[model samples]
Target: MRERVDKLKEEVCTLFTPSKDMLRRMYLVDEIVHLGIDHLFEKEIETALKDIHESEFASSNLYEVALRFRLLRERGFWVSPDVFQKFKGDDGNFLNELADDPRGLLSLYNAAHLFIHGELELEETISFARNHLESMIRDSVVKGPLADQVKRALRLPLPRTLKRVEMLHYMFEYDQDNGHNPVLLELAKMDFNLLQQVHLKELKEISSAILDDTYDVYAFSSIDECRTLNAAIQGWDDTAISLVPEYLRKFYEIMLSTFREFEDQMPSNKRYLVAFNKAEAAEWPHRNYKPSFSEQVALATETTGVRSLAAGVMLGMSDAATTREAFEWAVTSTDAIISCAKIGRFMNDISGYKVTVDVAIAKINELMEDEWKTTNRARIDNQAVIPVTQRLINLTMAIPLFYGYDSDGFTFGEQLREILENLYVKPMPI
Candidate 1:
């Protein structure tokens, strides 16, 4: 039974040997540090080090060499806490001397470690990262202890890629502030190329996240921030904007569509209605009300109503009024009728006439022809007089075509057709 247990243990160890070898070769000690394994299994690390030194495969010197290299590359120092009783020595200037050498690789490595480990905040780290990045960009070579360290840091997921992109964008803004337009342009090109390689979906999500974070900032931020964003978007290609999520595009379209609908429903003379019912029914609250003859005459006099009527005629509502003069007259007459109805409603409130149809008609006509002599002759003839007379005649002729309702002078069919024809026009083909 003991032999079987030993065999099982040996098989498990062999199975994990390849992974352990890879971890050692990759110098994944930093990864283990990030995982907090040092604190969790301190004894295990010590036992491993002891075994490495004892084994023929690894000499005592080999363990010390490996430890020295890791410390030099990652920590920017070769002092082993076990061996160095006092790394600083009696002279505090030793550390200062280490940093003074321009060609010193240890100094660069130390600076990078300080920057990546959050020993420096955003502002400080940005400067540090920028210096190292600039050095690489200018010379394409990193020398000294810091060279391999900085290169490895860049390859590692130390600073998130998205945050790095944001930092670059911020640098462009800084360049703009300093009037360094050429550098700003180069930075923009670099950022664009980097962003283009990112997955389209990821780019959209990241942009949206950025927008959301800046929403309130843009709304209340200095005008410069808003201007900068606008400029950035303008500088970008339309293809980049096209990559925005479809749902957001749809949202903008719906808003524009709503604006157009309100514009259509509003009376031209009045300030457009601020509120409109969106219900899609053709009855009651949603239904358009047809004005009576008196109401029509009143509308023609209201400035906004008159303008709206003119627009309606231009839209081809008047079949008989082909000429421009006739069309203008038709619109003016329609405006006057609407005005008359409004006035009638007002008078009813004041004098309490009960506003019967006959009384309303008389009021409308009285207002229409009251200044007949002073009216523009050509305008009155083509617009007001002719259009009204023709419309009335058309209604009279259509009486036989319609059935039911003979209480009024005009038949129901004639009245209904006149109202329907005025309010609705067939949609134009796309």
Candidate 2:
């Protein structure tokens, strides 16, 4: 395996074009880098890229210039954005003529995302290039590979998308064209297969440990397995019957189904999962750029933890009653479930000191207000919502007095597990 990879690496290096063909060479280098197999050929790529950048790089066309600038800046080269100065008109904007070139526009679309917050030209370029590229996609004016590439870029631009996800999507999208090097394509396939095996093995070990440990408590069937475990943990806390024999059986079944879902996601880049998960365009873009505290809480209700609680509620009651109460909880805001979900989300941001103990004291005080004895209890206990909601508002809004910014997530998760245990299972002895 190692020998073939070494051979393929050398073959890819040999494909690099020099001097006048430097622009062409950079295109291949960009693909190789984004594919994340560049570590194998890093020294060769660096040497070739530097040579191209130093030798007559400024004389290249718009596509070449944009691609070269993007690749160099991304690789930590100190090239100036002034390289784009030549492309501008007397009006001090990018030339109107440049919008006609799809390849150049695409390169600029990618380059714009690398802006460091204050680069005004780059910011303008993002809006300009996106408009042209998206118009092309919307109008069906372009076809074949370029059109497909446009659509893909619109969804996951180079800078913002996760590297592994990009490599996974591009792995299958990479086709050996008549002029392209087959050796590079073959190397990519081999490396992806190797990486995928590692991902699967790691996930399998995690899946096994989860089933072994949580089989006695609760298991979740309908969501991401990691989140399912979280949901099941909530179920164990939220209900006295979480340990009942029948519930445990359902828990195992749910756990098994969750693992199966993970396996299903194992084979492809998550385009399948994403398709099902994505809300329509009208419903997305989330109404607020930074979601408010209540909005975040409402969003958390859609998560597995909240739905997991709902599942237990529905399981113990008839459909008609469950639906009515669940709707009431959703509309009127069930303070207990809302607080629990908020704690779960914020636990990802918890510190061992303040957020940790604050959560404990607050939860204890909350349980004292109303005995969370039944699913319907929290829904109708209108008084419980005001105090819990107010406390939550204070905690989030007043966090700045201590941290001076939004919350910082820790390397550890759920620091108040004992507090949750007291609230959910049964109260620990004072």
Q: After superposition, which runs of candidate 1 have C-alpha atoms over 4 Å from their true positions?
A: 1-86, 92-210, 213-430
Residues 32-51, model 1: lDDT tens digits: 23222223233344344333
Candidates' TM-scores?
A: 0.20, 0.48
Alpha-carbon local distance difference test for all models: 0.33, 0.52
Clashing pairs in 2: 237-424
| Weakest lDDT window of 10 consecutive positions for candidate 2 | 273-282
- Provide the lDDT at 197 for model 1: 45
Residue 374 in candidate 2 has what lDDT? 21
* Candidate 2 vs. true structure, TM-score: 0.48
* TM-score result, candidate 1: 0.20
